[model samples]
Target: MSTQNVAERAVIREARPEDDAAIGELLVEAFITQYAKKLPEVVYTDERKRELRDVAARRKVATILVAEVDGEVVGTVALFPPGAPGSEAWLPNSADLRGLATAVRFHGTGLAKPLLDAAEDLARKWGVDAICLHVRKGAEGVGRLYMKRGFVREPVGDMDLPSVFLTAYVKPLK
Candidate 1:
C-alpha cells in the first residue's frame, strides 16, 4: 500500500472503556520494543506492566485519543494538566500529552503524528496555553520526534531514575 494510504487508513478518536486491555498491551509491547535494546530489560518488569495497564483503564478521566485501523486500535495518547503522568511536577495552564504508544505493527505508519496533533488540538480546546511532554534524558531519538513536531526543550523538572533521567518539553498553543 502507498504511504498515504497507510496514513489515511488510520482513524484518530477518543478511547473507550472496551479498549483498555488492547491499549495496555500495546503500551507495554511498543515501549519495550522501542527501548529494550537501549535500556536494561529489568526496567520493563511487572510493576511497569501493571502501571501501564492501570493507566489505560483510567484514560476516561482526561482526553485519551486512540488510533485505529480497520476497527483495531493501533496507537493511543492522552492530554492532561501537569503532574497527571504520575509526576508531581507542575506546569500551569499546560496540557501534557502523555501515555503515548503505537503498536509494533503500526510503527512508522503515521499513527503517532496525527495522535499528537489531535492531542495538541484537545489541549487548545481545553484552554491550555501550551502542550507538554517528557522523554528520557538520553533518548535523543525520541526527543527529536517531539522537537520536529514543534516542542521546545524546557529546562524545568527532572525525573531521576537509576537508569536514566526524564526531561520535559513544551509547545506553545496560545
Candidate 2:
C-alpha cells in the first residue's frame, strides 16, 4: 500500500477457481481475528474452518469476487444474483451480498469499499432494483459502513446464531 495511494494496493476482479484456497484462508484468518477477543472458542473450531474450506466446492467461482495486491489475494466477497436458488428469500429484484472477508494486514487500506462497490455493481448488472446484506447487531462499525454506503436497516429474520442477532439491510440501486 506504499508508493501509491492507499486504494491502489488491491485490484478488484472476478474470482477464478484457483483463487478458492486463498479466499478460504483469508476468511479463516479474518474470522479468527474477529472472534479472538470475545468468542475465542470459534477460533479453535475446525468445523467452521472446514465449512469455509469447502466454499469452493460448494459455490460457483463465477459468483465470487476477489481483491488482489501484487498477485496476492487479500479480500473476497460474494454477490448472489437475484432469484438465485439460495437467494429466493430476498425481495424480488434484489440480490444478496455475503461472505465478505479481508486479510488482516490490509485493514484500513481502503480495500473493502471498492470490493463492496464492485458487488453492488454486479447486483445492478443483474437488473436488480436493490441489494441486501446482513450484519450482526453488535457490529456497529460494519453497520455504519453500510449506512454510509446508503444501506438502510430492514430487519428480516430471527434465525440468529447464538448470541449474534442477525439483521438485514437493503440499499436501492438507481
Candidate 3:
C-alpha cells in the first residue's frame, strides 16, 4: 500500500519476536515526548523500560501488531483480550487496547489510522465486541482522533496526578 511518505509502503501485521527492540524504541520515543509534556512526574526508569521491552518480547496478549514500511518498523497497536489482569479504567467492559506507538519520524503521515484499523481487526477476530483505550485529558488531539473514528467517552476517575483525568474511549466492534 503506497502512502504519502515514499519511505512507507506496507501493511500492518502481527509483531514478530525480533521486533521487540524496534518497538521499544518507538514506544520510548513517543511516550517520552508525550509524557514529558503531559506528566513530568511519571519517571521512565530503566526498570520500567525493561518491563515494556519484556512484554513486547513475550507477546503475552496474542494481539500485538506492528506496521512496517519497506522493512522498517513504523507504527504499532495492540488489543489486549477481555478479562486480562489489569486495572486499566478504559478497558472495563471491553478489550483493553494499549501500546499504540509510532516512530517519531513518521508522525502526521497517516500511519496511525492504519495501525488502529489493524488493531480493530484483531479485536474482531478475537470475538471482542468492543475495544477501549485511555487518553489524558490534556491530549485533546489524540482523543479527537478516536472520537472521529466512532469511539464514545465513558466516565473515568482521576488518576494519581491532578488535572489528568483518565478519559476512557470505547469503540464497538460488533
Candidate 4:
C-alpha cells in the first residue's frame, strides 16, 4: 500500500499506560532491528535497549504519543518541554523530541510525519518557540525525513555520547 493510504488509516494520540509495552517493543524493532545497518553496534548496548523499553520512566518527563493502525500501536514519539528531564535542547524555550520510532512493517507508510506533526502541535500548544531533536549521526534516512519536514540542522546543539554521536535538528514554531 502507498504511504498515504496507510497514513490515512492511522490514528495518532497520546499513549495510555496499556500501550507502554507495545511501544517499547516497537522502539526496539524499529531502531535496533529494522535500521540495524544504519547505526553502529555500540549504539545498541544493553543499557540503551533497556532505556528504549522504559516507557514508564520516559513518560514521567515527556508526553509519549503513539500512532495506531488497526488498533495496534505502530509508531511513537516523545515530546519534552523545556527543562524536562529528557530534553537536550540548547535553544531557549524549545521543546525536545526523542525516541521517534515506527514499526518495521510500517516503514515507508508515512506514519512518521503524522507522529512528528502531533509533536509539533503539542509543542505549539505548550507555547514553545521551537521543537528540537537529535538523530543518530549516521542515520541518513531519518535525517532526511526530519529535513524534509522543515527541521533544520542545528549543529551547535549536537552532542557526543558514549554510545553514539548525535546530530541536532530544530523546527521553528514562530
TM-score of each candidate structure, all chains considered together: 0.88, 0.86, 0.81, 0.94
Candidate order by lDDT, decreasing, is 4, 1, 2, 3
Q: What lDDT score is found at residue 69 in candidate 4?
A: 84
Global lDDT of each candidate: 0.77, 0.76, 0.73, 0.87
Clashing pairs in 1: none
lDDT of 4 at 3: 48
User: How big is the positional error of residue 48 in model 2, measured in Å on the Cα after superposition?
Assistant: 1.9
Residue-level lDDT tens digits of model 1 in 21-135: 8888898998888887655543677887897887554674566789888788888987775545443324777776778898887677777888888888787777878887788
**Global CA lDDT computed for model 1:** 0.77
Give the alpha carbon lDDT tens digit for every residue of 16-37 in model 3.
Answer: 8888788888888887887777
TM-score of 4: 0.94
Error of 2 at 107 (Å): 0.8
Show the colliding residue pairs in model 3: none
Put down candidate 4 lDDT per residue, 55-118, tens digits, no spaces: 9998899999999888888899999989997679989999999899898877887888889889
Q: Which ten residues in a row have the lowest lDDT in candidate 3?
A: 156-165
Clashes of 2: 0
Between prediction 2 and prediction 3, which has the larger lDDT? 2
Worst 10 residues of 2 by lDDT: 35-44
**Prediction 4 global C-alpha lDDT:** 0.87
Candidate order by decreasing TM-score: 4, 1, 2, 3
Worst 10 residues of 4 by lDDT: 34-43
Q: Name the lDDT value of residue 25 in candidate 1.
A: 89
